[model samples]
Target: MSETTHAGNGISTEQAGVEQELVDTVLASFDKAEDPRLMEVMQALTRHLHNFLREVRLTEAEWNTGIDFLTAAGHITDDKRQEFVLLSDVLGASMQTIAMNNQAYKGATEATVFGPFFLEDAPEIPLGGDIAGAAAGQPCWVEGTVTDTSGNPVPGARIEVWEADEDGFYDVQYSDSRIAGRAHLFTAEDGSYAFWGLTPTPYPIPHDGPVGKMLKAVGRSPIRASHLHFMVTAEGLRPLVTHIFVEGDPQIEIGDSVFGVKNSLIKKFETQPVGTPTPDGRDVHSQSWARTRFDIVLAPGSDLR
Candidate 1:
């Protein structure tokens, strides 16, 4: 019998060496990948994955369970919904990748998760126009200035914004073709932009899928902190995707399901009582409103980009 086949009461060194041999064999198959980066990634993935499985001494049943979970996620992902991104978000993989790529530079605004709801065809809003076409929520006035790291104004910067309505549902969640709570607008020559939208409230990520089941299995909450999404781009600046989380959200104190909350991103959404004067002098009738200002700074473009 082969030495590797010998059974023992405890884990044997020979078995460990045999497992490593299998890992090396798998990694060697990636050597012909024309891309050196792909080869490196494959090799590293093999090593880490094998190490984790060995560390946990995963059983055949557990491995099958994992495969089934991934299959379920794949089955649920589609054009409007992304189950894999949700899985990555819940596992902190998305945030880790964001952190590794978006290292601190100057005073550039911090980036966060680009949640699954962003749409490429969001309607355009003129400066100081309204984005809430038909979404239902308390009204909010969002204004911000886009500037470079040096604090110079960045004119013509495109700002994309989206958020869920009062009931914590994004426009894409509707059955009928409804678009609301999302729009894009260009910064003015002075780098200022404003829009009327819904006041953000804490919302649960789509929890009816495989990712949600996994979260429930681990006794974790699927609730994310209340925040509005932003994606900013310009001529010579690194694109910024981030959020301004509403202050005092209970989920922020407990924890954002996606681990996306940053202290710098937290801002107070000041409440305006009924009949208070509105910015831009727009009429809100007898309903109170909310207002917030987010100043965005962009990092310079890099040669590699």
Candidate 2:
């Protein structure tokens, strides 16, 4: 190879002429990065990426197409929606990540993906109030207690809850003046919380991205199981992000589109007489809902694991 002198950065121009050379040079500069965590992540990323490229003999056109797909995914995002999250849901990455860190909360309500639809600062409803906005689906009365893994009650804990209506749509999916079907409630003195809501339904993820295309290519459905999303937390305790699956929902056993449902999370809800009052004294006569119980046992320490 012919050596050519270059003025900038001291290397011979021939060694620095190619795009790959520039990438390597930029990566090499990270060796002196002060943050250990950042350096570890960057080094692993570089190693895996280089290995992938070499293993697949990746072509420039293929790499460019991947970039374009990701760009298109980002372009489809909006304030109330996240296309990248939908992509993760379809690719099972969301559940995998949740499972990885949630293992320590083993005996607790098993954690699941906090799908993109959760609203921040949800309306603060009272302990037994309904979060469901509209008259949709059969009524369901969900009752649960928040406790530590040691079986001790956790009073004053907060549980943020959200779920889809009967039609498998979130409130954000529509633009009416109706309140969002979500709520934040503080646990009662007995570590208990109860609420009225409609039964959950399987829902489709956004199907207009490369992730959707991948799902189609694999002959898989994009519908997630009917379940409730909960983020429960108490002072001095690790927060819990989890779901309660409706028993008999075939999607739970077969396969959730996001691979989120766990067998231990399934709870059976039984229909009760319309005139019957719930444990919290709410009359069911108006909607004829069923009752289901869920008790969450939080893992201790600062880490939920």
Candidate 3:
């Protein structure tokens, strides 16, 4: 191989070796990171990132465009909206992280994306309580039980649930500062829980920002499959974050925007005609509703292995 010199930094100018020396220099710089995990992560990230750049032979203009897009995303992000999380979801990064951290154990429910819409300190509801606090959607009867892999009840497990309204907006997305479509509730001594929530519905991700523009450029749709979010926490079990996707939803065929749909997570949201007897006898005059059962199983301990 003929060695051509590219003056300044003494970087190799050989065809295949052009980027190798720079990669080595960057990896070596992380040797003193003090934290072994950080060092490993940085070195691995550097290698894969460099490999991507080299594989694409990315032009300076394309690189600058990416920077500009991220800058725009940052500017639009605030306490209420997270543009970066949306970006990660569209790129499959969020699901990949969840898969790596949520190890499979006996009968334990799988974990999915912890979307940006989650709010802290959601209101607590009683058994068969309604969480729709004013958001409009068909009433959904959600009942479930929390148990260990051995079928032992996890009494008093706290389940946090949240979902978008029928119009595809979370409570936080509204400028009025209203709170609805989200709440937490604990299980009974028998590990059973129930509440009234909206039936899952398909919705587009926040698409008025930089991530939206990128999706357009890539010919991708921003639609997420219909799903209801759940986060279950018990005293001695691993925290489970997941969603129950609606079965037979046409959107699933197209794929979830966040790549979060799992076959095990899909459940039947059965439609009940008007005048059906309510489980808790909550009145919904002349309104049809839906019902679903999602029994949860949590693995013991918090080890991510």
- Residue lDDT tens for model 1, 252-305: 999999999999999989999999999889998789999999999999988422
Residue 282 in candidate 2 has what lDDT?
A: 62
Q: Per-residue lDDT of 75-154 in model 2, one digit per residue for the tens?
A: 87877778899888767788888878878555766778888888887789887788886747777778889999889999
Task: Please list the residue runs of candidate 2 whose C-alpha ends up more than 4 Å from where it truly belongs after superposition.
Answer: 1-27, 273-287
lDDT for position 268 in model 2? 91
Q: What is the lDDT of residue 246 in candidate 3?
A: 96
- Best-to-worst TM-score order: 1, 3, 2
Give the better candidate number (1 or 2) by lDDT.
1
The lDDT ranking, best first, is 3, 1, 2
Of the candidates shown, which would achieve the greatest lDDT relative to the real structure? 3
Each prediction's Cα RMSD?
Answer: 2.2, 6.0, 3.2
Candidate 3 lDDT, tens digit per residue, 127-161? 88989999999999999899998999999999999
The most accurate candidate by TM-score is 1
